[model samples]
Target chain A: MRRADRLDRLQSALDAGGYLRLKDAARLLGVSEMTVRRDIASCDGRFAYLGGYIAGGLESAGGMGYILDRERDAHIEMKRTACDSAATLLKPGETVFIDCGTTTTHLASRIPADSQITVVCYAMNIAEIVCKKPGLRVVMLGGLYHASSASFSSPESLEMLRGIGINTAFISAGGVHESLGISCSNFHEVEIKQTAIANAVTKALVVDSSKFDQVKPAFFAKLNSFDFLCCDDGIDPARAERLAAAGVRIMLP
Target chain B: MRRADRLDRLQSALDAGGYLRLKDAARLLGVSEMTVRRDIASCDGRFAYLGGYIAGGLESAGGMGYILDRERDAHIEMKRTACDSAATLLKPGETVFIDCGTTTTHLASRIPADSQITVVCYAMNIAEIVCKKPGLRVVMLGGLYHASSASFSSPESLEMLRGIGINTAFISAGGVHESLGISCSNFHEVEIKQTAIANAVTKALVVDSSKFDQVKPAFFAKLNSFDFLCCDDGIDPARAERLAAAGVRIMLP
Candidate 1:
């Protein structure tokens, strides 16, 4: 194979699998381990650690290689649709509360710059987006920095929340079951979500279809806590009906 | 001086000044620099490198020493008094949000453990207190950790916040003025405070009397964004009246 073809094959293997041992890549490329190492080095440190090479700074390849190379199973497009639908419910002048999660981030891009609304958030990404909105105001609650999610939360965030109220709050859940309500993988997140519900006049739950029926370790609040539950069209109708029966206005698009 | 007395003197010097150079300490103790280094080492790394030797790990002291010594500030009592009076507005069972800063941290201790409220925060010190409060639900936001204040902020935190709301937001401003509104020293903090206000129904500005009239780089909100303004009795009456005229209920103690 040509050197370029070998490199392409190596990239394809790494993109398909998030991580690869050196020997595996070598075997797949039908090249010696030394040749594989040399090829990786030619890429200028794009290959990292035991996790293998991740395509970095190659925006021209449609940003596909980087996303595919990551191990996450969630679909970004579904999350974006959910977020867009959630953003439509917020008025220009209202104060909107946002929680942290990859799905909720899609709402940030849709928030209109002309809106006079104030956005209060625990998610740093949303805060950055709201800050750029011309007339929109943004607030970030201070807390412990969780590196994986890149957000802050602690008892201090709750303390600062005393005496403040919100017009609306948007939340995400790791799992949504008729009996389990909204659940998350971390106990700390449950505390934050519960507090968010307690303070809002209206609550909306934004989650993708894939999250349904999946149970996480912690329960933050019951499904009844939310006035609106937004999910993609892929959600099972029976489950949607159950959510609607619980007084949740279900939105599917 | 006796050995104990010498140690006390060293500590006192550090307290009086923010730091004490090792060479300076040696001259004062009538010992060589090496001997001083050995003496400090005897305390088992209690001394920190402050370009030289600084007292370390003395919690009783109130100043910042190389060795993590707590030093007594001349304004300690005044700050404590201000913090005590400000903390009374917070009630139990309410979701509280705390902003990031040294003065706001003082309020953390006053939160009664018996209260059934959940606390969400970005301040690490405040989380420590919430952890001690039995049955108090503590939620921590995850994000990029800021070493200066030991807090976190990032896109992930914004995403996480989409799921929750706060009852009240307790925010501190770099500058609180009748004309300029509430401002912060950094853009990131401004965004965070704005998010807190939007998430809550009520907004409370907690500031020392000295913070009034100071202008910061970024504007978080107008003075009227808050429902209540809590400050020390030392605020100028004219300025307080101006704030009250701007629709902020002034609370002075």
Candidate 2:
């Protein structure tokens, strides 16, 4: 088949499935994965190639939001331990803000089913889990649903966060550099996270040890902004000392 | 155990599980289901027993919202048929509003994965399913999470709906009375439904045949407010004709 024919077939498959994996596109077009990649590259701005999946131009142009599933199992046990330690800080009757991320999902689950606390969240994954508990009241921030993160965000959601009195804010980050500050993948999340930090009595940064020293695209807060850090025992002693010296307490599980 | 002790154990279980079935509560207290029901009844304002499940006082006092799971299987095939018919009205590139309810979930699923349309929804269940499709841009109106309905609603969600341009509003209701108007179980859903109806170009009411003649607590719209009724073959012909004569077209699968 001609290269044009192959590209047409790939486009048809993407139109049908909404998205196609690179390998799937190759098989559907009867070409090698490398050929499929080259074909997609040839069509500038025609498709979004993110995390091995190809999506239509409309979605690509809108934004290729963060894909949470790929990062879900990256550091599973450590995330759970970190979140478990973080969950302990939540007291009954207080309102807490749970940030949007896979690590915070573990914290959402560790929350006592009958804690009688109100949970303020912006992510679907976190809200769905806690909403079922009859003892917990859930305040969900609404906005445009980003398929990339399975989370909601808008100016209205940020405004909603400001009005709520949060006792503690359990925040998640993609990177936690001492000097460069804390960051996450989506730019939409910055204002909401910053608002939570400003309004909450205690701002707790909950992340696995692997996030240390890494800097993601959207920076939200500085390291000193958090009251403390909840993480697993995988942190290097020197690194822990550095954070501690920087006036950020590291709470390990 | 004394009656007070049994009540204490029941409260503890309800706290741990958020909610418990009557049978499980009885087993945990080592008593008959009837005895457990009596105990819950004796507690009066302390416990909420709804649809065979026992929940804590906080949830019980905060309005026993409509439970979607219990109604999920009732007339399910007919609901699916009705929603399937409703889903056909959707066109690519048009923005639509999907109302919250178990029946609407079918419509959410049947939406073409590659139809480049924007879906505005207030329910977590509806948002979670449609957000994964790459061709769909989802605008989720967020607010307090209602566990009974697996939906979100707030004053701001209504405000958010007012600003968006909705081409079609696919509404679901608990009751569809001819003279009494359309109604739902929760009062919070009323304003959102009314706002969507007032703003949209086409208002379609999607309900199973059983909903006809039923009168729920919250009334949101009159029968003539809808442009069409998408329902199953089970709808009584006489009733369909009456609705048609009243200026509402009935679209069936």
Candidate 3:
């Protein structure tokens, strides 16, 4: 295959799969593992090899906020399914904190248009879409702007979040594990997520099944920090049982 | 042309022209004025007859915030040139206010990438772009979200704006005239603008030639309210002199 075609195929796979295992990617692309390795670097620093797979912008794992666009499109049905379950928690006149994530955007969108509520979020995408929901007030946290996440998350954003009362805080995590706890890839997000959890009356972690049984660099909250977990049905029954026994309710959809 | 095609054409004209004078639009669309009138209603409430032209969502003129999208695209080179001149006024380490307008967005974009300054804006578009500039602090005013303008502007937004001290205020006006002064179409914007002018150390009005020689419904400030006016070169020499003579330095770009 041509070099350009191989690189294009690699991006498609990475975007859809979020992570590309070298051997699997080679087979999928009908190229040798060596070719995959050589061509993968062409993605610049967007993908980084970790253990067995190449992850999307592993460098971004440091601190820059950007929507994991490809991973977002990957498990649409699962994200929506989890979001649908999350939507049931929303009540009229309640204030909510929506963390920036694909699953969370779906959760915000699932709110019925007629319901009256106040949403405080730092993400531009969440703020923009949530504003259209009828009878709702949107307060976009002001601070340092991160275009990738389309939200504000900094010391100032955290300061603004501190002043408000959140009835429910739906947190997004890079990894959710029974023992390792809830974690994220970026270091900068740790403080804000911690603040949101600490300030809210009720805390819940929203993630797809894919994030289960994994660990990320920056640990924000423990599994016990959330009152419950809302996820897709793909999660292992045993793991779900362990979390449920520990105290957090496992909500599957 | 098909009905959809004609409607699309009408929208393009309205978007480009802000308000499309029926006779001129009919000539451009190669249709009779009667046909133009008949088809315009099909746009639902997106466009309406205002005096002799079809205006964008005449209902919104009451107060809702929106960008005159197509009209901003209408005078790109002129807007950029005006923005370039405005950029010269930005000083490193000083905080500034950029009102929600394409002209102002251009002004934000034209700021030197390496300049160390703080920007407080209500528009998402401006925030998204300005955040990318190096050594800059971007503070998006939090309040009611308006998708049309991609910014926050409300009672809460005004309160937030009042708390900050801006070294320079780059105001976007709907119309600028010698006698009528600075005015805007929406009533909700007047007080916030008035507050900005009052709180700002230095204020300058930014608009293109199209906005000159007219008066909008809601007047916010007088000719002497601004220290200067940044406008396109197309503004007539006589009017420029009148504004200049009235304590507002006229910058033609």
Candidate 4:
């Protein structure tokens, strides 16, 4: 497992459970207590060290940009392959909305250097990468900063998003299930994702195969909400057929 | 010098002179040609190395977010000391605007991890630093991304700035003169700086003594625009006194 993904999983566990015991976080993340300790340390002041438990400050302030930087390396190949598949759908000069997610980050990385596209983003990491491409205009939504997401979200951010016309949007979520549809762990993020989907002409849910059939709380979109679903081949065959039968276009690796 | 600051300085030199010979950049930055070679190499497609001179993509883009990253280390001690003096003016819980500049990045770094303050910024580098501190809310004004500045700016960005009421603003500039006042090379940046000064209750001009008495093209504010001037004591006594007499408070380190 990649360390960034582990750290993100650890943060999710902490946010869900309020506090995570070092042993449990390590066991769930398939790592040692030492790695979990290091993850917490790398988080700097975002996590409070309470003896055996790590307390993540997800709700202590507004819109903690919850992008776990280290998580980018976790499941690296799967993310890259999935992102590459997603890129096949993009055309030059199209205006795209990229949300803050470890997997979606790969799409930004995969974007052609010389592609003249307008990227609408909500985070620093993506902006840093996308802005370097010459002749591209990056519109970053501004508002309350969420340290964990590493993106901005608030009334203002949503208002800003409403002003842009998106041709295609690659949205991300923590999990998807037949019943729950699509969801992420953080409830604060759901509305922004929904808003992006609402404003986009064509919307695709870009998640890895591991997220298939799983369900997270704070549902954002229904299964039919998206025009396409982009994921790696790790998806179960049976579930893929079921989703495709339900009218969701699947972008396969 | 840090790699980011070095790249920024190289780009600034490239922007000013249009072309920079390899030997000149190495000699000017007081680094080895090998290090300069690596910077051009690491610009990661931003620069085209044509024989002996480095080519930057300046005119081919918009707003260029040119707050020099590596140049933060150019006058390392002096910039830090000037920023340290500026830090003394900050109070807990106040909303402060930190503009994109090498010297102001020092202020972001120097901010105590435990200090509870709201940071309003337009760039990712400072947002990444400021959002790490727990209990602080970061409001990043988002708009069109400028690759060189590594920040966002637009007419809409200025509109957004007009809405926010700032307690203090630590503004940066390329030059400061008794006559031309505070200015920067980019004409695109002047309006935003002017808006920040107008919205700020109290403002401080933060720059190294190197900028003293020099003048850049796009003047943003006058000597009396700021409540305090934060710089190294390397400033000329006569000039400082003349400015002090003109009602500009000086914060020296």
Task: Report RMSD (Å) for each prediction in the order shown.
Answer: 24.6, 13.6, 15.8, 14.0
Would you list the rank order by DockQ, best first?
4, 2, 3, 1
lDDT of 3 by residue, A182-248 (tens): 8887666778888889999988888888888789888998889889788889888888888888898
Among incorrect, acceptable, medium and high, the docking class of model 4 is: incorrect
Q: Which wins on lDDT, candidate 1 or candidate 3?
A: 3
Location of the lowest summed lDDT over 10 successive residues in candidate 1 chain B: B60-69
Q: Which regions of candidate 4 fall more than 4 Å away from where they truly are? A: A1-74, B1-73
DockQ score for model 4: 0.15
Q: Candidate 4 residues B1-253, lDDT tens each?
A: 5987677556433421134668887986789999999987876766656556665532121233333423433574577778878989889888889987656766876666667888888875566557667677788888777666667776666777888899999999889888867888777777888898899999999999999878888888898998999998888889888988999999986
Report the candidate with higher TM-score, 1 versus 4. Answer: 4
- Residue A208 alpha-carbon offset, candidate 2, angstroms: 0.9
TM-score, B chain alone, candidates in order: 0.71, 0.73, 0.70, 0.72
Would you list the C-alpha lDDT of every candidate in the order shown?
0.61, 0.76, 0.68, 0.73
Recovered fraction of real interface contacts per model: 0.06, 0.31, 0.20, 0.29
The DockQ-based CAPRI class assigned to model 1 is: incorrect
Error of 1 at B78 (Å): 39
Off by over 4 Å in 1: A1-73, B1-253
Ranked candidates, highest lDDT first: 2, 4, 3, 1
lDDT of 4 by residue, A134-172 (tens): 667799988777666667776666777888899999998
For candidate 1, lDDT tens digit of each residue in B1-253? 3554455445433321124557878787687887776666666533443346363222211111211112113333334455656677787778877776555655655566678776666644445344444456666664444433435566556545544578877887767766777787667666667777888877888887777778888888988888988777887788777778878888766
Q: Cα miss at A84, model 2 (Å)?
A: 2.1
